[model samples]
Target chain A: MSSLPDRRLLESWQDPKAAPYVRIERLTKKFGDVYAVDDVSLNIFQGEFFSLLGSSGCGKSTLLRLLAGLEYPTSGRIHIDGVDVTDVPPYSRPVNMMFQSYALFPHMTVEQNIDFGLRQDRLPRRERAERIGEMLDLLKITPLRKRRPDQLSGGQRQRVALARSLAKHPKLLLLDEPLGALDKRLRENTQFELVNLQERLGTTFVTVTHDQEEAMTMSSRIAIMEAGQIMQIDTPTAIYEFPNCRFVAEFIGSVNLFEGKIVERQGDQVLIEAQFGGLMRMRSFQPHAIGTPVMVAIRPEKMRLCETPGGDGVNRLQGIVEDIAYLGDVSIYRIRTGSGLLAEMTLTNIQPRTEQALTWEQEAVIEWSPTSGVVLTE
Target chain B: MKRRSWPLLSILVFGYAFLYVPILLLILYSFNESRLVTVWSGFSLKWYGELLHNRQLLDAAWLSVRIAALNASVAVVLGTLAANALVRHGRFRGRTGLELLLTAPLVMPDVIIGLSLLLLFVTLQQTVGWPDGRGFSTITIAHITFSLAYVAVVVRSRLARMDVSLEEAAMDLGARPLTVYLRITLPLIAPALLSGWLLAFTLSLDDLVIASFVSGPGATTLPMVIYSSVRMGVSPQINALATLVVALVAVAVVIAGLSMRRR
Candidate 1:
């Protein structure tokens, strides 16, 4: 986790001179009439843990399969490490995939499963054994090397699948929901381990996942996809803090969106006359013309209990607390304002739960700073 | 524990008796000293000893075993290939027609199959001047033609139920298509192939009508010999042969069961 900050500084995508390791050019895959992966182009920098985040049926897995050469693009080309491989089959590509189902060979032991790829490359017996041993140790399954897939637990099978995929030391590894099959506790622990392994090996990883927290925790950059098109691609921090569009903002996490029109703009700030009856002064990275319809997206945790309710009504809202959900560390207060808009606010319980001040049906006032949220034009 | 109902117990006993009485009677009579199948005197191994020396029956039995082995081997190969095509190749051209044709023999009466194959062999001999006469080759070919359908059915169901990702994973790990099929797909579906081979062997061994129609004078199968002998009169020697067959099949089944359990 400490290495994350340093890895962020070495972000090759931020540098224009750094060439991409994988370049997909307008890749499109169609199964009959449905476009599984529509015309989409993306460049993944070397040694980066990139994630394709989306709900099911959003074409993320299809895109990953296209990269693995398991599913060829109906049109467009794929270039990996400066070589065209669109026509290459999965076996011939310099890429390996860890399927969502793990897909371990039930007939083979762990050692044999991991040894399969090295054997395919015609490696000598000694070298193959050495590589198998190295992989078993790396995944911490040395003792289970002689066990068949069905004899191992789910987590052990996952490790064996990971070891097998990494045996070849492919230039790029595609993972389709790599941690989707694990229990919740194991999934969280493996997420960090995966990131650390990626950094240590410096092998570019492209994983597809529907878990936003998993994506945010492990990915150096997250690509949000919807309906076979990428909605946003940026660092996890940027994707969370400053989503480029309404779809991206709502998709990543819970956000309270206020539909409004921009009535004033001064430098990097814009004043939007919100539909909830008050004006919202928000920081905007992009310029918005006056009278342009937009949305002010603010996360629930950013909203706080207003200290001085009557001082200024610019970013303040007075409402009745309609619902209070006590969630151990924090409490969610659903405030229904006079305009009949439900604004959700999350407050950390700094004190004991019994000493909390807010309650259901109580009149509460919430306010957010201008920089705490973003204004999206689309 | 619940008490067993008298009615259910009687029905169970009746079912068992109905199925096993004839077999039990035959086994008992096989050891009788008397030559009459229905009459019993003292227990003896004379019929078993006489069966060993019966030249015609021995020759027919050997011919039947050879034809069964050859038919099962050839059917398994062709049938497994057919199953692979139907399962792995997703909706290729003429798939429906091919599937229908493959299963047609399963429902076709043995008489129809025998007559049609006999006609086909005659026409082939007249037109191409091949298959010159019907005997061992003709009988084995006829058996394989019908046995293939049963083998295909068994293998196809197993192949369909298999996890397809195993093969895909192999290919992903850099195995070529042929290597993937050989290393991953074949090993996983081996139990199905074994069962299919055994099924075809039994079908070929049990066949009577088809063998009679296709076989010329010399290639008399065991079933044909047993049926002709029964037409004359029930022979104690045939009972001894039947008992041996049942024992061999039971042993084979036990071996297969044990091996499967170990896996």
Candidate 2:
């Protein structure tokens, strides 16, 4: 997991005077009539692990391809390290890409595959061998150097692909679903290793991934995209805890959204008159006019079993547990409220399941503080 | 294990016999001591020794081999280019028309192709003052015209199935387009190239109608010689030549199969 403290130290994007290493200005890519990347402008600082997070066909991969110079933008310009590389071919650009398929040349051995880029640059034979040796050792794949791609397992092939792409020592690297082919256990382990590799090498990395957890675990900042446009761009914690819009809130993680209209405003909090017959108070920084329609987005874990039922009716709801999923660490209760809305709440399994207090069809009351959820206008 | 059915076994046996019986008979009679191919007096190698010493038959066979080799080499280059254009360049302008033109030779009758190529060569000779006599160069060109189509068909399927990312990955790692094609693309599609080259060589070697249509004086190929001699009379020497051809083809097939299995 990427803790907030670790990311706070690497927030170069927060510095107003920091210059971006990779700057994409209003980039748009059209395949025939459909816009794959539509006027998307973004800036990535040097040494930052940036991720373009989206579902398949949402243009995250297309955007990464544009950065790699694999796909030319239909409009706008791309600048890498203060140079306009918009019109440069992929080979001429100072960048390398790891394809999602791990496109290792089937005819070549691991050593030859890693040596391909070095040979292209016409490096000296001795230096080429040295670089190849370093890459094999760095990726811990020296034993498989003589083996062809078909002889290697999926994980080994992935390492070979990574070593080959990194052998040239490009300033920036682009990865398209780098860990996508691995199984669940391997993927989780590789995620941390990949982040550590990027940190040690100090190479600016831009990765495209559909898995939100992978993005959250690795990226310094994530750009959430939808339908060829970015919905939000922020740190993982900020994006999860305080999404600017309903789509980002729903897309990142499971959140219970209560549609409402603002009826009251305090110093820094606004009271929402929910459609489900409740007044929900939430902290807000964005200015909103009275009677403006909005939504209060709250995570399932933020809601808790109410201790005082009659204290306040502001953020309290009465419901009957319809289903209980007994996960080892936590149990999720899907409760049907009085207004027929299914409200989900996850509680840590402190006691054994056999002695659990709440069961199916049991009446329960849940409550949350005003600062627990954000008020979204869109 | 399930027992095999009698009817299915008989059908399989009949199918193999129908295909191989003529080849088997020809091979068996190649060793016949009798002058008549229908009768076998005793096993002998006399015909093979005489066939090797025959000057005209040997000359014609040498010419055919040279023409087939040259034609296969040239056809492989041109056909591979066409396959690359079709498979790598995604649906360019006039793609459908080019595809139709490339495939037309596959369906066109051999006689029609031979006649059309003869006409083309004659016109080019008169107007462009090239291919002065329809001998080696002209015959090879004619063979290439039709052989290229088959080569293109074989190479195109392979090029289509190849992962385009391999080339892209090469380019991404600082290899230029030409270097990427040479190192990554060509090596990956080499099996298809080899098979295509062999196919073109076999097609050119065995072709009779096209060679007859375009060949001038003193430019007779092996098939033309074999056809003319068979028309004159059944020669035991020709039987020996046919058996040698069959043996060469069998050795080639075995080698190809073994190489494919190794990969």
Candidate 3:
């Protein structure tokens, strides 16, 4: 081999109007009787950072493995850049995967590991050497190029694995829990670096992670999976603020649910005779039949607290402070109403605005703006 | 220490002496001048000088070296493949049965293996016309079959203890399957392969029964020559050859030990 390819080699190879980056149709993986990745069809836009987010056993990793061509789908079609690749072996796919464990080749130094794919391509020796140098500089790991994986720290090993993966100049990159092995601070820092690097290189990344926060911060859009099915596919804010069901409502973030029956309905709002104690007025874009049982989902941060009922908002209820929790930046107050209502209020630490804090057993009023809550018809 | 530990230590020590004493005695008597067996007169290097002149023993020794070298290299490759399959691939239907069959050669008696292979060669000649007669070729095949079991055992344990995610990470990093095996898997288990080859070499060199059953008229391995010579009383030349064998073995063992320690 001559050498590794330089930056210009890869930059000049980029082509537009080539093909659809990846089109997955009804991809399903079955482990005996269990559907690990159910009949799922999705289109990955070119150069998009897509995330598969869910808890463990939700089959997010399985879907990613399918896309990486590590595991074949039982019955489905996979096309990469418009080529049918359902039966293509992982090595033949124009995709590379970064494992959750950040598997760096231990026997070789960092540079050799990154140069592995280029060597496989039988590239000219000069190009291989140049590409290796360029990747080392691009990944900011030139200083550690000669070190074995064991000598490098967790984050450095991750970067080496990434450099090696990207050195192949793959059209797609599959990240399996990329930041899971790092400390919290390192994870936060590396997440931004990964995003910026992906943007700079413009490789379509399909990341699989159980960390909701990491997905929220890194991905352009996330597929919220549950029990081998996607519950919602949207941006992080949309998934959090307007969950389509009770499961999505609770899984993504904390929600205060009031199970109630809608007794009155207006043009765009309704009055819910809550199962707890009072009537709650909620904004409903969803069609709700009167006298039908429903649930109102409200985030604690959206709720405002006071010692007296002075809200112009229609959804107001009086309750006694059952417990007061003083967190560092914010305080959480658990208030109880008649007929078993446990309402939570999160108060920001604005010292001069001492009006929000409450004492135990103190009677208080909790209110939320009508539009801040969602009404789940089911 | 436990009450059983003292007895265990003594047994191990005594076992070491039992194993070493004969080799030590053989080396000492290689210098004998009396010419009477077991009755040492004084020490001399006359037998060593005589051993340098024995062309038949020297040729057999050379043949033995060639056989061991070929067997070890072939066995290491085959054994590493078998070991990877047994470790990396999970249990499917008939896998347990395959494992049982794979390991049967390890504990089977050498005489049975020798006789069965001889029979197999005869059957192949009578039916298939391949390997028309048994000789060095058949002997090496027989040795490869039995020695491969030893090599596979070592490679298997090394592979089983290996972290599997290492290979997965390589694949995830854009390595083709064969490249992952060659670059990552082979390098990681290289120590195991080295020791396995060494083991197969020693076993082929030390073998007598199987080589005897399979050798043709002209194919005289060292152990076959030594076994035939042992029926006659002790010879000065045999002692000289034994001493040389002892020295070569000791040096090889020391090299192996040093390599293992460094690793």
Candidate 4:
């Protein structure tokens, strides 16, 4: 896990004067009539592990390809280290990409694959061998150096591809769904390994992945994209906790939303006339006038279920437990409120033996603090 | 396992016999001591000895080998380039027309291709005053032109199946287009190129009608010699020559099959 203290230290984006290492301004890539990347602009600072998180056809991969110079943007500009590289070809760019499929050369041995880039530059024989040896040792692929890609397992091949890309020591590295091919356990293990490697090397790493958890776990900042456009860009925690819009809030994690119109505004606290015939009180630092239409969103983990309503002033609802899912670490109770809206509440299993604590059809009170929910206008 | 069906087994047996029995009989009688065709009085190596001493047949066989080897090598090179252009370079001018021209020779009748090529060669010799005599060079050129089409098809299919990202990855690692082609594209498609070359070699060696049209005096190929000899009479020497060709082909095919299986 990335420690909170280091996160704060690495939060250089908060500084207004911090220089961006890579700047993409109004970039657009069109294939025939379809825009793969439509006027997307972003700034990535030096040494930041950034991610473009989106599903298929969302243009995240296309954005990364544009940065790698694998694709030419139909319009706008790309700047890396203060140099404009919009028209630069892939081979001429000071960037490298690790393809999702690994794309290891079937005919070449692992060592030869790693040495290919070095050989292209016509490096000295001794230096090339040294760099290849260093990469093999770093990636723990020294034993498989003599084996061709066909002879290696999937994981071994992945490491060979990584070593081949990293051996060149490019200014930036772009990874396109790097761990999408791995199984669950290997993907998780490799995710952390990749983050640690990027940290150790201090190279600017920009990865594109559809997996939300992978993006959250690996990147310092993430850009959420949809339909060839970026919807939001922020730190993972900020994006999860204080999403600027409904799509960001919903895309990052599951949320219990109360569609409503604002009824009262008292400082940071606001009362909403929810659509489900309930008056919901929520608090936010963002200012909103009375009679504003909004949706109040609270994460499932933020909501709690109790046998009886609490005495404290908090949002509460009477509901029947429609579904109970025991997910080992936590139990999710789907509560169907009296107003016919289903709200999910997650409770951590502190006691392992409490399997039947909340049974189906049992009446329960779902409650949450005023500050736990964020209001979404979109 | 269940018992095999008798009907299917008989069909398989009869099919193999129908295909191989005549060839086997011809091979067996190639060692006949009798000079008369189809009369196998005794097993002997006299016909093979006579074939070794036949200077004209031997010369023609050598010429055919040289032509076929050149045809396969040149076709492989040209076909690889054409395949790369077709598969990698997207939407070039006259792409459809180029594709149709390349594949036309594959389906065209051999006599038609041979006749057309002969006419073109004679016209070129009259107008451009080059290739003055139609012999080994003209025949080799004709074989290469047709053989390249088959090679291009094989290499194109191989290039299509190949992941394009492999070449992109190479380029991302600072390789120029030419370097990427040499290091990545060529090696990945090497198997297709090899098989294409072997096919071209075999086709060139086996061609009779096309070589007869393109060939001139002092450049008679093995197929032309064999065809002329068979027309005159079915001699024991002809049987021996046919057996030698069959052995050569069978060995090449077996080797190719084994290599494919190993891969």
Highest DockQ: give the candidate number. Answer: 2
The C-alpha local distance difference test score for the whole of candidate 4 amounts to 0.89
Clashes, model 4? 0
Pairs that clash in candidate 2: none
List model 4 lDDT by residue over A233-266, tens digit each.
9999989998889998889889988899988887
Better of 2 and 3 by lDDT: 2
- Segments of candidate 3 deviating more than 4 angstroms: A1-21, A310-314, A317-322, A352-357, A361-363, B1-45, B84-97, B122-134, B159-185, B216-219, B227-240, B250-263
Q: Candidate 3 residues B1-263, lDDT tens each?
A: 64668888999989999999888888888899868758889989998887888888889999999999899889888888787778888876777886786688888888999999888998998999978677778888989998888898999998987777777766655567888888888888888888888889999998999999888888899998988988987787788898888787777777766655432
Off by over 4 Å in 2: A1-10, B125-130, B257-263
TM-score of chain B of 1: 0.95
CAPRI grade of model 3? acceptable
Q: Tell me the interface RMSD of model 3, in angstroms.
A: 2.3
> Over the stretch B151-175, how does candidate 4's per-residue lDDT look in tens digits?
9998899899999999999999889
DockQ of all predictions against the true structure, Cα-based:
0.79, 0.83, 0.41, 0.77
lDDT of residue A284 for candidate 3 = 87
lDDT of 1 by residue, B60-134 (tens): 989999999999999999999998899888999999998998988999999999999999999999999879899
State in Å the error of residue B186, model 2. Answer: 1.1
Model 1 ranges with Cα > 4 A deviation: A1-5, A8-10, B1-9, B255-263
Better of 1 and 2 by DockQ: 2
For model 1 the local lDDT of residue A162 reads: 94
Alpha carbon deviation, residue A142, candidate 1 (Å): 0.9
Candidate 1 structure quality by residue, lDDT tens digits, A111-141: 9999999999999999999999999989899
lDDT of 2 at A171: 79
The digit string of per-residue lDDT tens for model 2 on B1-263 reads 99999999999999999999999999988999999999989999999999989999999999999999999999999999999999988879999998998999899998998899889989999999888978998899999988999999988998988898988999898888889888888887787888888888889989999999999999999999999999999899999999988887677667655644443
TM-score of chain A of each: 0.98, 0.97, 0.90, 0.95
